[model samples]
Target: MNINDLPAEMLIEIFTYLPEWDFLRNARHVCQIWKLISTSPILRQNVELSKYMDSYAYPLKYFSAIQLYIKKLVMHSTYIQTFEKHHQDVKFENLKSLHITSKVQCTWWPNSVFNNFFSMFPNVQIIKITPEFWRDAENCLYALSQFSIIELDFGYYGSNSFGTMGKLHDLHYRFIQFVQCQRSLKILKIRASDHFAEDTVAQILEKCPTLTSLNISGAYVSAESFKISTNALALTEFYMKSQSEFKDGDLEALTKRAPCLKTLNIEGCRSITERGFRHIALNCSHLKKLFIGELDSNCVTDVGSDVITKIAKACPHLEFLSAIGCSKLEDDCIIDLTSSCGSLRGINLNGCTNITDVSFFALADHCPLLNVCEVRNSAISLKCAMYLIQHCKGLTKLNMSNCNNIDDKNDSELENMLETQSRNNKPRTNSSVNSKLDMSSFSMHCFHSHLKDLDLSESMHVTRTLATKLTRILPDLISLKLSISADIESDEEWFQEIFENCVCLSEFKLSTTTIQRQDYLKL
Candidate 1:
């Protein structure tokens, strides 16, 4: 199939995957037809001015062509000239998403600039604003309410002129009024620590019932007064962290309101108890991701896990579960979890010392889809580790760092099997199985081979010989996290073996605790 003979639609689709500048500079210059497809408004919908901030890599006329197709304008003060009103009549007809941010503060953008910016994109559906830019939020809110905004991320870093009770109330009233007006609003993220906006947030939730995801972790949420009587069935993801207000009953009530929730993270709620966990396990049966890790104390102990199995039984579709430092859990609770939630992909049981080899046996027997398993500081032994590797063939990540019983004997066998595979065939590459992988980010992409990610950091029994052997075998290793082995405390030869054999590694995290100073120099 000649490249020139390919249909225009296919060529356009291929061009969309190329980097923005590469498309304009290389692919577009291929031919006249390619240039037309490259400059299409659909392809240029997400217009970011940040790349053009540092240097004038392209001509002014090139940007003029881009201005016509630009739909989502991302502005940074560093790139202020890129968004200037040179083409005042440019109607930005397809504009939907607008974000203005500054990593380094320049002169505060006045309300006049805000008014002009809003006027330019009258059809925006997404707005990400550094709230400090708006001198008077009331007028800006009124203008935003008139637009068809469905998502808003407000990072408010202005002076607290609303510190006084009366001014704060008026500000809250305006924000709630704006929230109510946006009938199609679905995602809202607010970042302002001062002025606990519990009542205002409650009012917004009550008014904009269509909101699906709400993140207010950057703001203080008054849990004492916040109540939700009406069920927002559409709301699925909610996060409110670092708060003392979430009592046992509040989360259960919130879950009852948003029963279809898929992801819920209340990691900073200090007052949450076993009852709240039980409520979530019972009510939110559709939950796919749940995070209930606490900082101050263990919220869900053994007693909680007993009731939390209701989650495993009810939500068998659960994919990700994290309950760090919840040590009261025993083997049966984990057994119930592995037996019920067979679709579980990743689980973190760090600091859960009560669990033994029986849990691993259950995981090996039931969970075939499991990929990542972290059981740091657990009681899993070498025999059980071998059993797990034998059964769970699909596991790409297994972190047994503090499971001190995991010695070099069984892992030596893995090294042998890997050597056998490598000796029989060409070195494994990502292209071998790229179709099943997610290539959105190079780092996130899997190596597409057996045992892509491995961590044996704290397991002191990993000998220098086995380490070198495994490196030669696992040719497609994308990540290898390791600690200095007890016997091979500082072997530069062992480290060299990895670089020599594992050419495909993209991430290598090491802890050089036991390496001698001179040994480090040798490395």
Candidate 2:
């Protein structure tokens, strides 16, 4: 069959996967059939105006065909500035999602431009204002209050300049007014800098009864913030990360109000201890995803294994858990959690230096659905890798960066042992050797075909031989990250071989510790 002989429905479905720029710039101009299919409502559902802002020299009719069918629109400051000049007649009645990206700080827009810009999208329900986009919080909040926004995301960069306490108070008042206008607000993500006080959040919780997801970061949340008169019956997902003032009492109060919480992220909140986590395990049994990683502070030493084991027993339905830099965790905690929570799909145990191969063994034996595993800066060895490859058939993304135990010597030893065992057909002397042989045999045959993303960065012992073997085994890799050390002989040949084998690879990140001029040129 010819390539273009497919039905229109199939063609539209294929074209729908293309990016907004590709579909508008290249795919639509291919042939008459493609052009007709490109004009379909499904293809024109998302219209990004920022990409076409540079082509303002084009006629007004160039965008008129897709304007009416656009359900989501993305614009930038440059596009909004010239919107009145170039596309004044463009109106999208069906637009429901409006994303505004800004590079330079915009304080305020002229009344005429602001009115015309917002009047075009009458039914916008989701508004995403990116970081450093607006400096004047009052103007931004007042303008947004005019629309009945259901989901509003004010990016992490709160206001660049709230010069005085009075101005910050005014911005907070304006934000509360904006939340008051949102009668059906379901999701609200805001960077709570100086703009949100305890009273402000309490008022918002009291007003927005339909709110299900609330993400407030970048500020100190007092224990009294979640203390309100009415119960948050509809709240399900709450993320209060990096709040220095958020303590165990705050978590307990919030859990009492939001009893139906499912996904919670309290990472970087150094004040939250094991007591805070116990509150979650007791109140929020339906939780599926939890992130308690401490990214920044070095003094965070309260998180231990006992509380995590309690959480595992309480929240057995947890699917994803991230405990990055939680150095207090040992093998027993991971073993208990993995054995208890059989449905776990992804786990990040980065910087848990005490975790050894025992945790991986438990993961392989208990968690069959494990797909994404990150064990950076740990004490795992090649035996653990072999076990995961042999058992976890669904494993796709694995990160073993900075793991000093997985080196060229261990790889070579394992290969030699397997080769000798195959030649002699003899029973292994020890149980560990027998287990290694079994896993090695399975790994040799299976080749881990499901893996697409692999990272072995900062492991100085990774040599070319192991890299080639991995590239050949996981041929469908989309992202591969490696770090070069002084011991590796040649970098060019292995990189070329990797590129040839992994045909679907798109992102390749390479770093080197020892930089020689000749090696640099070869790379």
Candidate 3:
């Protein structure tokens, strides 16, 4: 059908699928009718309109003409001066989001520049400034008191041990005071230099009473050292990472404080023990997604398994759980989880050595819809893996890195099984049905043929022969990661042959000593 013949609504639906507005420019050139439709107010308000305008312009083009039109503008050190030169015509009025990463020299200037730009944009809602622009940030915060800014992301670029200094203590105090006074800020993400003091965080939380989402990933805030004020009762999502800073009793304290939290992630918090996890489960009963990482063997042996098992029992509504590197977590805990939490959909247990392949097989047996299983650095044998491949058909992503037991020997056994199955399916009169089935080809098929993504990195025993064989077996494989494996006997020839054979493969990683990057690049 001609472009003009298609209904306008249907055309709009087609246009929605295109990520950039620039597609409309080409669409306009198609005909006069399309040009008129493309310029409509509705089309001009395309969600990704800025992306369209950006495609044709240099990083620093006529700043004034494009300034007001830009919805989300990210300014690195190079383009900061460009925007500063056209500072007046460069209206931040239409800018819904602004991210400025300036150099040390441009700090003072960017602040005054934004002070002018932001004052005109009454609709300015989200502002993110790099640490280089912190001085400018404080100025903008002070100047744009009228702005209804809802989201603020401040990167770490401060001086004088910016992470640990008490300079932010004053800013926290003022920010909280602003939160109490102002009405628009609902999401606050602050990446302090290193670690923040408890009093500083408390001050900020107390002021931002309406805050629903808070992420302090880079900031070194131990559960013991940092405390959220009671005002954080409204919070629905909280992310805290304190793996580098080891302070006792912090996890327990933090969980107890944030009772209303529905999505809690305490990744790399090594000090968090069973007591801390229990405290979290007891307090945050509403939590639907929990991420607990960096767990040591001792913690898992002591109470880590029990902590997670009990959480599964308590949080019946939990949908996603990522407890990677918790080496002590065993098969029984997983069995208990699948039995208790029927709502669980995705679980990532990478580096949980105590879990064998049976853990995955059992999880598949119990959980009807397990989609993702990442069991890297475990000792799961080939038997359980085959069981998982057969049983967990719903799985999309499977990581069996370091499971070298799944080699040619295992393939031989699977071929034997397929041979037996094929023999049983043979008919007396129609022996041709047996030939049509291609039992020899069935012997070559891997147990998991439907897998789209497979990561077998660091499996030292895996050879090029087995890798190539497996790729052919799983024809639908899209992403394959086989890093740090044993080198191919004839590297150059083997790689070229493998790449040519694996037609469906898109993302391939064969780095480390097993395969040089340059050698792989040659393919």
Q: Against the true structure, what is each candidate's TM-score?
A: 0.77, 0.84, 0.74
Q: Output the worst ten-in-a-row residue range by lDDT, candidate 3.
A: 427-436
| Worst lDDT 10-window in candidate 1 | 438-447
Candidate 3 is scored at a TM of 0.74
Give the residue spans of candidate 3 off by over 4 A.
1-71, 90-95, 101-105, 119-122, 161-169, 195-197, 220-232, 243-250, 295-303, 412-450, 484-502, 512-523
lDDT of 1 by residue, 1-523 (tens): 7776899778767767876667656877888888888788777877555545345435334656776577787766444333344433446667778887653232355445545656667678898876442334555676677687899987655555544555555767888888888888999988775543567677777888889998885665656434655545577888777667777777877887888989887776757877777788777888988776654333344335675477788888788887776787778888998888988888888777788999888988898778888887778876676556545556677777767776666664565455555445533455535423422222221222545676777766655666566566456566776665334544566555566566666445556543332333332
The local distance difference test score of each candidate is 0.67, 0.73, 0.62
Error of 2 at 349 (Å): 0.6
Candidate 2 C-alpha error for residue 316, in Å: 1.0
lDDT of 2 by residue, 439-511 (tens): 4565244444567788888876777677766766566677887775423455555555667656666546667
lDDT of residue 181 for candidate 1: 85
